[model samples]
Target: MIIVNGDIVAQGSQFGLKDVEVVTATVDLEEVRSYRAAISRGLQAATSDARYQRIQTPFELAPEDDDADIEKRPTLPMQPRMHPVEEEIALSGGCYLWDYLRRSGTAGYLVPLSGGIDSCATAVIVYSMCRIVMDAVEEENQQVIEDVKRLCQYSQGVLPKTPQELCNQIFTTIYMGMKKQSSRDTRQRAKELAEAIGSHHVNLDIDEVYEAQKKLVVNTLNFEPRFEVEGGSNQENLTLQCLQARIRMVTAYEFGQILPTARGRPGGGSLLVLGSANVGESLRGYLTKYDCSSADINPIGSIDKADLKRFIAWAEKEFDLPCLHEFLTAVPTAELEPITENYVQSDEADMGMTYEELTTFGRLRKLNKLGPFAMFQRLVHDWSIDRKHVEGDTAPHYTPAQVAEKVKRFFHFYAINRHKMTTLTPALHCNDYSPDDNRFDLRPFLYPNFWKSWSFKRIDMELKKIEKKRASKGK
Candidate 1:
């Protein structure tokens, strides 16, 4: 029912109202977004009358009311203001999985659990799915029970007994580690986490597979590549690392396609594979194309690293999974490089930027829609030590030259690796800014380096001005 304002009678002809079917009163479309808050205020205003006649549309909600309309509007009780979406991000993620499972009729879910927080957060979300399923069953939600019985292939009178049992029935976690690159601590952490979550777990060393994959190039080029720690060049190091990373994707699909039959689940089917690449890494383009980032669906693709860590901490206490605390303290690593006494590969070190910085850069570029010059302009003051624009600021201290250099470096890596985003797995939408090119982010995979652009050249011009200004101030 479209409500047209009584005063705007002549203006109603402009909207082509025939297709709309109902145009009783007119409204300001701009105010529609705040309609919820307005309803709260209306309820507060009408607290005395018990027969609360709720206004159906914004057209009926006028700040000042005349006698005729006020007589028709019943008063409602004033209530405490509250938002129903406080836990929407985390809870809605689980709901996304459940919705997909029932609609698609997938047997369950499979995750390439790498013993990192990204994958760990994915596992925790699956556990939350189990919690949601059990809660539905306990509450006797008939529709959910019917769907559960069909998915689990349970006979009449049999129902899910616990979240752990439901998890084991629906979730499978595989840790594909290499003897040389994967460490004992990460391997053990994956095992402990799976046990805590009650997922069907598989653990194996893929050193043999890693070596065999390398032979494709080794046999063709008559070359044996080694990691950086093993005296290999940067090109050779990256080649070997990608070999290990891609192997995980191949293994995940192979297991996902056949796990139902192997487990004797009655119907032969496949599980929806989960990807764990966080938004910060996706933005930095710090992932290999078609590596483990390729999956049936990604839960953390849009969620940033800092928020993912906070979610993990929140899940540890809320879900009672003590094993998650270790992931919080553990250093973030790709674990593609060999673990050594002298060298442990850090994710931030490999990418040449921290996750926090990536978050800031991503927001400035996408959310703020700032290009190279504009981003440098914003960050110069934001990250400047001397010019603390906001008091009690904790941003990293950097000179204008340093800020400009960092900006150029980030856009360089971001531009070069953008091709990877074109294939980034479709992730759950939890964040405002995401570089998942396939879904939320839509941009060209190929482009000239932003450093060469006119806006970028202005950074150097700006830096020279700042330097000259500082030199004169010293006099």
Candidate 2:
């Protein structure tokens, strides 16, 4: 019997025999028999125990039924466990970070809160950890209680009373901004979210730091780079942007190491720097290498953009942090580029693909096992009249050529940025199609931007045929 929310629910030991049979079909009959016998012995021991005998069984055999017949009966079809994916992700990521902190003897987590969906999700996951620990303490989980005590450095018999108190102890958020690069709106958002989560928040401007670094580079090279708006070349623009991003990374680590001491705790303890790059951005290679993406651990790295958005929406209600709703309306930006009077930079615009499309491309490339040409072929049908396009076309249809171009462009960037994955922060494995190089994705890092084989040539020919067919239909 199980009690949930004040209601008593009968719980049963149910097994999916069909799933077991599928597994047994791959192994030897003797091995299957041995496995079954081991399970039987374990069950017998459990049933014979006084504790087990006191518990009521969900199903009971009739008095007239023979024990042999009961044993020979097939196992019942078990009910599949259904839980919200968002809740599961929160629990998994929260537990992972909590365990990492406890095992590594780290003080807590330090996040560079950019007021973006990715960073917001990472912060909430840390907040979730506080909630989980509070629940464990309430339930009197001794191991968790001991771990929390040591992690938080609480006195004997003193436990955290609320999630906010635990959060202030464990999580630190820093919004590193440049006057010209980061928006006031985003900075305010980060500040409000930090307050909502009760984290130790710091708002620091790095304009002088950025200028100093730029001057040093200019002095060394005898030249300086500028943004594209300032008449700089693409290389110059990228170099300048990367400088700001790399500097933020450096600053984040410094704070992560000293935050504990700053809070009046003993020296030598450091917080784990958390990364916020999602799987969709990773798949499209839309992030700067060694930037915030190069942190100690990324809680939401394996999650897709859509899922992260959903999680954000869920968090707003679940955590009672309504400030998360701002991210939904806010445009996603790196804020590395110079802010113009009229021009605004967006993540989708920079990547040449929306987060939604990136999620589709990632799923096709990994989960569906589709390469460039195959993906192009499938997407032509999948993203037909009913689907949205990158160009904001709502004409209820996309030509085959448009779909092919989208596919080609996606693969082109995916290959060029494959090397970035080598240095990608270790991310929590939440999705089936994770592009993390450490474990979930094991493809070659060095790949040609475009396929250079006969099969690829054949796919090109097929695409041309498709183009021709579409032209004829138009006529």
Candidate 3:
């Protein structure tokens, strides 16, 4: 909803009729039209009552509201509001990852392209850095250029206009393919962007990789004893199946080694894990235990979803790249699932809470405010914590016994799939807080530890007593 200064205007009001007492000025044209449309559709949803109704003033001489300002106001600040120290630390950590890969004699950064803002930003950053590295190499070694030119020819199976042209073609094809927008426009734009930046992009049909990897994981899960036939385990087992396929540490390891030892150095390329605040936190626990967050490097770990979108906008305009809008507007999904429905945060049938909710409970447990069972259910119930639970009515309460049983159920469901969070190389941590780092280790010892505590028994007994009393009251 748009508000001007102190007055409400343009959007949010659903009723066609405007109240005059609260609104001092005439109803704005946009607001009138929007309200009219809403009323016509018979879906008038008012956010506030008369007490908070906004009054508008005459603004005949006012300048038109700034479109850029409107776009930035609520969204831009969330990005890496990094203090100089924080940025220095983040950049230093990125450099460390690059350096480590270089010393290891690896090549190519492998990032999963989601059409969402995070992946787009990551791609832009990787493309930007790859160009810089190539330029520095070209200045010192003429043969370096020749080798890249030849590699480009071999990879492309066609002659490129220039060394940079080959690089652009490769990057563009790969970028578009990864994002799942293999349309002619996206391909042409990616090529254009790559040419402008002088970077080599390779298209490796990530969908094919996702498919092969997904099948392998599913087959492995189907063999697991714990995943055997059960009533409620169907969805749980499917989620675990995803965990195995999603944990492509081996794939990442190979991609990490793709850069030739003689070409540009390792770590010079980075696998930017495009993650968000929620996923980063949930990953702190054992779910998807080996995938998504398990990356050799994470550039946007500190950036929130809203901020990431803003950065993408900045990058699009600064680089004169196409798809800035398209990338931002695209659905958020890693395409790691076999089914089309398994894509995006809002994919309702995806089944289960996100990594963030699990992480929140883990955090609560770490702080010792509540036991794992209690925290787990609370985490499940806290609609704000998990997007899946958000649309439901108020969450129900669970006693210690109920929570204990639920914990056991969840653990049994998740343990076999813990491989989802595993990774190849440990991440470079700027400090102790990073759960995205490959070095971070979490154990399920907490669940058992809490289960054995006296609190668990006491809660179970109390729940039984309450049940008995309620049953007897019928007499």
Candidate 4:
């Protein structure tokens, strides 16, 4: 007797049913060419939008065009100073933390300074708050206050040390991404900012650890339409995961271990003073879920990226840190990977787009005015459907209700993976809004499901039209 085994799964979903000609027939040479062209157009549009979103320049200004005359134009006072009351409130969070640390009998803050805008701002705030605590303790324990003051004086050199430490770990990454592209000397600039802030500096070389952790992190991502590292492979997924894990581990090491030892304490305070803003929530989420996960307090949690930049500029004038200008001069990057290496593979050498392409489409849909979040959920819904279509198990469409079920399943899969962020603390919990600190609340899951339902309602109508066409053709 002969028996057939169904257990032998093929390496790729698209390649599994090689005997099915229809599945293979989707990619004609012309179709591939058009798809590539559409991708190029889409990329151009998205990047153009991002560039316009960044600058003091108008949307009409060409990115490469010289506007020397515009540079000479008198800069208006775009940001007004905060009211005295508002300023007092603005400075209160740091004060609150300083008192918390003092009462707890902790030695001092162990800041994992990255020397980026957020971390730079954080280190300065911590330094200022310590000063306040020293003042409070001045009359009671002059010796301890003086010790704290002397420590702060020694640590004043640390501000510049933050950038240097960051450089030691990812200087090659910064060079490839920033140095090669522009004449703007970012390292010198970051160094200058560090000096202006009067903080002690230390350089740590974490390259080997980062590389080793990258592999471990990649291996942990079990769910996927996965890719193998190969010739001309962009390694984007690896790059992103590596970047996230490195940030998480580096912050954890600096705060959880080194800081306590440095301060001669068992552990640190309840609040870690995260410097995140709201505008870059998506980017922040990507970075925070990785690097900034170790924080207990996020001072700017409510501020948007736009408002945060405004506040930084305001601080530059108020604090007299000329390095603030230089700090602002450097382009913002998470320092996750080299720029020459495509963060997401733009090459369309294959018939089907890579996983990066799918994710980009999903992300772009979420950002576009046509309803970015809804579009993102819809695309994810379609990825599974497209996979099924390509397998020839189903025609290229599903009912509205069916699509909703698939979206729900996709999210359900991710929810099981929520254990990924469970170890980290969330930054803030607003009275109206839940803290984004990944505290594993039931709410975040609820919105994705709602969006998924909306997506099915919108797309199923179109899919039904496609389905009917196939049904009629069977005659």
Candidate 5:
């Protein structure tokens, strides 16, 4: 007997097939029997192969153990195991880029490789997508093969042999350097990583473009914006930095739209721009709006700083890209400011909190649902260090007052920059505490930048109580 399966319920409910007349059809019983017999023979041969026997590991009979021996055997409960977060993030981000490219029929990905941990992580994810496509082709995944062929515009039956070759076809890395904005070390690192990952690397200086923009702005405003080092006002300093960042975005899209045609490809398709902003920076509102935050997609948008560093370390070994080792130990910087001899701006310094603290703050704010006052109340103990009386001197690492101030500052910035989240590029939702507005997080964009009236009163009362308790203890 032969059995056939169909969506009978869907046909009856939606198409009124239930009212239609039932028809019977004759089948070729002899052909069906022959097909079954052939399938059985194939299964028998596959199971009987010596290679199958060597590969399979069946349980032994346990040497006919006695009842007492069986009772004495330890019973271990089954434990649930999850894939590593590193693997999950990498695979998800890689597949996201691949699907986006295939679905949109885009040429490839264009990443502004800044040599920072975030951008490096983005580049690695693109490389991972190349590896995934190559693996799929190896496994004879027809859909993947066809998508890749169409994406690269390869003729029929012409398949890529290696991940590197496929990556060269699909990925382009650009390093945009302005005058004195990017360091030699960072540029070298970007070049080395792109080479190691087999991406098409383009190094261009945007000094002229920046100068032209600056001149236009000066001509319009009758003043040239200067950096803080040159004794510019805070507004001027920020304006100058933002100009550089925005200029880079304009330049990136210009290249992304034309790089494929520039490389002599037949069809002119634009590359999808990839953003590299991490969750911690986004939470703290440290990123410039529409700068690096603006892109087609952000692979590491929901990822925290610590996890990104861990991912870089893992990628160094897994992808066999040793150039990622530099970012592992290198201090994270935006490099938007001039590299002066006296003052060098770091990401942490500008954010007023370490990445570790930022990670904690982000988790508390989103995962734990803690407001500013609540967060301050919790972090007082989390950040506090026990002070032992050593030679009659006691010094706490972080006092409650200090913790409260940090919490307040964090929330203030978070509220003010909550508007930026509305424009954030679609990010891979791998994190538990994502602040993505489109899906995971839904919060008001316009915030007062301060606590509500009642919340402020409560926080003030709490702070006063803590101070009183501290004063009594000190006495």
Candidate 6:
């Protein structure tokens, strides 16, 4: 049931199957995109309305002492202090999580916290979930109170007094470290955030299990693998990296299946394994297939990296989890490769594209519905030195040739990694554009090698037009 223009309405009620009606209504929610956007519009209107006082608020973003821009503006002095859009971004993710966990019978959530921004964001959402539940309880929301009590297994007089107490009961975090790759810093960071949110934390290295698997693979296959830093081939390096990721995924599930009982909880139920892959990484296919990306649910998956980072900065203050500050500042890495003084793996460097560019690519591809050649044609104008269309574009200015290459490189990797999305965890429908294959963005996973196709030829043809134009001017 949902409110339409302040009136409660039920969808698909004509069907005899009540279950189908509920499933169709809540599942994916693609049919109601306009409705959700309308609600955001309503909030936007509320912020700017003369009657309501402005309040900056997940519920973070510190307010400016002086609204210098507002003060400067003679008109529109009533500009809202809080951005309703960003507030919806954080709240939409948390609200869906609470809805899912509350209705679905589960012990709690199990997050494979890698101590990176993505995972930290996922953990923070759960913390936000706890806060949402408590807020509901404080408002004397009886339905939410019943769900919370049942999920927490609180009986009779026993009840959750705080978000921390509830979080400790439900949320669990695990950090699987490798002997050669994992960092001490990330481990400490994960522990600190878990403590800040009051989650039950587990820290252990998978090196012993990793070594055993390596030994088995070596003995059975009569071959051995090494990392790139160890003078090994590219294939070996990737294999080793994927091995760690795959191991972590399996370990996460093993723990999720048993953590409830292991923690001496009332029930021996399974926990939902939450994925941390953000929208940008999913678009660029930066994650290992069936690694942590393959999970029961992902809250931050549809949201892009840039906004996710902004949300984290906001959450640091809003949730009062200061430990989130480190996550915001720390460089992003898979930590799959062995760490060396000169050679720790960086996610952007490995992808050969920045997260910012990935966001642009994702928007153009999914939202603009642009093909490779069309993307180059469009971006060359926007990202060119002249910045013809995008006056405020922050992207690096590039020549037509360079822009073409970047577009090709992104599409090439995206094509090769498209199969991975088939198994992408069901992420919340929060972003304007999502590459989620399960429901939202549907495209052919298989594509012909467009490198030698008419697309590339068209790109070359377009580049010549620019070069010829420049050459004529010079002459």
Task: Give the per-residue lDDT of model 4 (tens digit) for 315-351.
Answer: 6776665676655545554543333444422212221
TM-scores, all models, native as reference:
0.81, 0.81, 0.43, 0.46, 0.79, 0.80
Show the colliding residue pairs in model 2. Answer: none
Cα RMSD for candidates in order: 9.8, 9.8, 17.6, 25.7, 14.1, 13.5
> Which is superior by TM-score, 3 or 4?
4
lDDT of 2 by residue, 306-388 (tens): 88888889999998999999988899999988889977778888988778788889988889999877887787787676454
Which residue pairs show backbone clashes in model 6?
none
Q: Taking the tens digit of each residue's C-alpha lDDT, what string does model 6 give over 23-42? A: 11112233245677677867
lDDT of 6: 0.80
Candidate 4 — what's its lDDT? 0.41
Instruction: Give per-residue lDDT, candidate 5, residue 356.
Output: 83
lDDT, candidate 1, 198-282, per-residue tens: 9999998788888877888789999999888999999999988888889889999999999988988777789989999988788
CA lDDT, every prediction?
Answer: 0.80, 0.80, 0.44, 0.41, 0.79, 0.80
Task: Give candidate 5's whole-model lDDT.
Answer: 0.79
lDDT of 3 by residue, 119-218 (tens): 4555565554444335545454444344444444334334444435534433331342433323434445444444455554444444566446557755
Name every residue pair that clashes in candidate 5.
Answer: none
**Candidate 3, residue 199: how far the Cα is off, in Å:** 4.5
